[model samples]
Target: MSELGKKIATRESYGNALVELGKEHEDLIVLDADLAGATKTGIFKKAFPERHWDIGIAEANMTGIAAGLATCGKVPFISSFAMFAAGRNYEQVRNSIGYPHLNVKIGATHAGISVGEDGATHQCLEDLALMRAIPGMVVLNPADDVEARAAVHAAYDHVGPVYLRFGRLAVPVFNDEATYRFEIGKGIVLKEGKDVSVFATGLCVNEAREAEKLLAADGIDAEIINIHTIKPLDEKLVLASAAKTGKVVTIEEHSVIGGLGSAVCDILSEKQPTKVMKIGINDVFGESGPALELIQKYGLDAQSIYEKVKAFVKQN
Candidate 1:
């Protein structure tokens, strides 16, 4: 069955995981910057009203409070829009939570241009780059519902600061239920091939897999890698894949700069030399539209990836 027929999104899975977290840890505190409903933290608030905190519409203050809660031995999973969480709480995340190395988990939803119809104001195409730039922050971009649920637990278990970015739209779960497992810093190799290595994160990973299928039909062998963890980048696996493929196409919903594209190129530059074609939102603010249309307009959709892979296979 196609994953889309399953009808589940990573954001909804996060809501389910937060409820489980509150049940498991009495020290678990759920905080939202007035976006609990939209960010899917409303499920946590509904399940555990006492443990869930509505910190108004202030993202910065929410970060500060999460830091304070962390200092008191509480695991604060803060929720909000990715733009507000990453752009607004950047300094607080860098100095207070990260510099102090606190166990503060940030579950920022509505990441990427997937914040459809919300336009440039609410859409966050650069949040991944911003969060990944932090020194001690553990950056995550789960591919779908299964990985999103796993990431919640993974973030809960990790000792220091963690940032998880999830989409506002529904997507099919790409995780292989039997053998797949989520690790804090480990990447998943979903499909094995040598023609082109497509390393992708978040919802884009699903698109990359779809693109891989199309590439295979066109007599191309593409490796589809689910790079769930972006901060502690899996350089060894990526370098090995790049070395084997010689040609790479990085897919992300966020900007190419300082995001997955840059990270992959960094790995290739150090351990191997691979020709990388970066596919993502290229330094452009997203406009209000349907999510799929916005994806195509921004050149971050599966078709764009297919074309890039086709062009790359011809050259390399």
Candidate 2:
């Protein structure tokens, strides 16, 4: 949690990081499809007006422009809502960015079901699956403000097409910059236990931590792992934890169909077979409601995770 006892949205950290990065990297350019204010890219735009480009509301064109800028030795960070950046411009992103392996960073904000009152039209639940399917695309989902700030720097340092997912909701700041180190393709173990391993990403990571506490009270030691990177997952760490626990549980704000749950299942099934349980949206679209209430209704809350894990641990 933050020292001030207030939650901060990852998108806010991203906007602040971009301004700092702009001061250091002269070649860094930011592009937005007329959503600078909503996506928080307005902060970067204010800092670097000369380097920022507002390409109107055309997402596909904005992607192409970013790709062109990348080809000319410029590191372009394109910002938009997740639905527009990853959903509306999928084909352009696939061919213009992913296929060419361009050095473009897609800063997709308002991801998952946490975009309160926006309904399914604005909330993006399939971005992880969509981005993960692209070859050579590095997918990053930050769990807190600190991780989000670090992920922005990591994406800039990496020399390939990267998809950086951010959420609109303010989540708990669980990581300390002094001790916590963010690495691409690495999973951090927040807590260690013996009964079951809980793998989580993005907004669900904080909830998983709460679930860890609940499980501890019940004499169930649950190991909690924050999987910030969805692509090129930390297979070694996951396998090691699963080997010790023998049971696995995955939680994400996205759908269970092709999100973190699917990714973990694929790894466990291939390398070491383990009983796995998934807690997330069960192939249903989101409706307009309060973000916290929607999370509880969809069984993505900490209590729901604890109950599901208890059942899974008992059965397995």
Candidate 3:
């Protein structure tokens, strides 16, 4: 578990990864809708001033520009908050990027309830749902700094429209570079168990790991799987785990209606039927508060997950 005490934000890793990528790829261009500092594209702006573009709060126009750049053989990474980047510019992304299938990487930061003190308007709980709806869009939600760093390189290498989700809170680092590998559409099993399979994505992956420990203490061996990619999901891995455990619980920092929970249910309903429980926001908007407080309120915290899983395991 990250050598026991290292904590880093996924957004911090995204920004630093951009600097490292800038040194290698000359054709890599970054565009931000005047949120370079908040979205952490400021790191790229400082490293390669000529390659970075501040589009001044014009999210839709930024997508258009990135698409145009992509046509000329440039790999453009667009940066903005998830609400504005994915929600505000949905039409542009769908038509300009998705339709054309351009080489554009969208780095969406401040996603979900962890956006803390920003209230419902700033918090984006439906980004995964929105981005996943767009055809050919690669949706990536990195669990920690190490995965976030690797995801940046993977997105840059892949040719198509991609959405990279990053969080504002500093979560515990559970993966080490020496042992961890990031692959698009691949799920990583952190712990193997026979009782129940706990599928989680983004910041909730760490909570699932903690919940695993709590469940183990109570004689429940919970299998924990980290789903870093939401769309083009690892159906084989998910179905195999669910087949073994027979009980499933999905955790995410998104709306329960159309996020990782819905994605898992969609798979299970099609192939193998299993009793599933989804742990996320219950079709409600988030309020202004500390990140940890909001997590507890939404029942996405480790303790809450543990209690819910313990009950679900008993019932099933």
Candidate 4:
């Protein structure tokens, strides 16, 4: 329970990191738009009551408040449901946080169709695309708890607007605290191979790993790259992986359009001419079910990756 364990959520990692980082950085402040409990920022509020602000349910005002605090040399981490933080407060985030490029960290929880049982409205599938469109926003979707904690530290040290996407449902904890390191605008080659590169983020990274095992068993070697930071995309690393593997596949719990897949295509179309494939949500809304069922239905699960990769390997 202390260190990395199986089937852990990123929210828990952020909850622990906020308390740990709050202890060292006195300037670290937290703002929650009535989602202190849900977003797991309540841990920080329990200790640093003075530094934590529960801004009611007004997400737009919360962004303005965070931006205002950033001007005074305070590094504020705003926590709320992803739909509210990124979907509802787009202008506030864009005009206030993104325009000035404030040192505000946004912990956008419950992203993608995996935010099941809450239905499509609550799930923020287009968050990465929205955040990526912002001029100075540094968008991130960590692979697991270890990367989640590490990204929190990196975001704290980073000076600018940061959008952190986390999941509501727990997945396999595939990383170790000691073995992993976080650097902004970089991708990690998890498993090296020469055929196809599976570039993924968020929970899809876990699915991609599982899919890799299936592919490897069939004698199809696949390279896996963890794209933690999406906005300042590591295009060079992506192109290099594509060049080395010669085939690219992107997996994400987001839309096929304007998400991780689109980001990878933007790079490969210019530098590498490798054939790329993507597995993600189509142009449709999510529904109520178990989180895993929703991901599987939306083609954001391991089976989808396996099918897509298998087809790609055959075509190649």
TM-score for each candidate, following the candidate numbering: 0.96, 0.98, 0.98, 0.97
Report the alpha-carbon TM-score of model 3 versus the true structure. Answer: 0.98
Worst 10 residues of 2 by lDDT: 1-10
Clash-forming residue pairs, model 1? none
Which residue ranges in model 1 land beyond 4 Å of their true spot? Answer: 1-4
Local accuracy by lDDT, each model: 0.87, 0.93, 0.93, 0.88
Q: Model 4, which residues run further than 4 Å from truth?
A: 1-5
Tell me which of candidates 1 and 4 scores higher on TM-score: 4
RMSD of 2: 1.2
Report the C-alpha lDDT of model 3 over 61-168, residue by residue, as the tens digit: 999999999999999999999999899989999999999899999999999999999989989999999989899999999989889999999999998989999999
Error of 2 at 111 (Å): 0.6
**Residue 107 of model 2: what lDDT?**
98
What would the per-residue lDDT of candidate 1 be over residues 70-160, giving only the tens digit for each residue? 9999999998888888888789888888889999999889988988999998888888788888788899999877788889999999999
Q: Model 3, residue 70: displacement in angstroms?
A: 0.3
What is the Å distance of residue 133 in model 1 from its true position? 1.5
Task: Write the number of the candidate with greater TM-score, choosing between 1 and 3.
Answer: 3
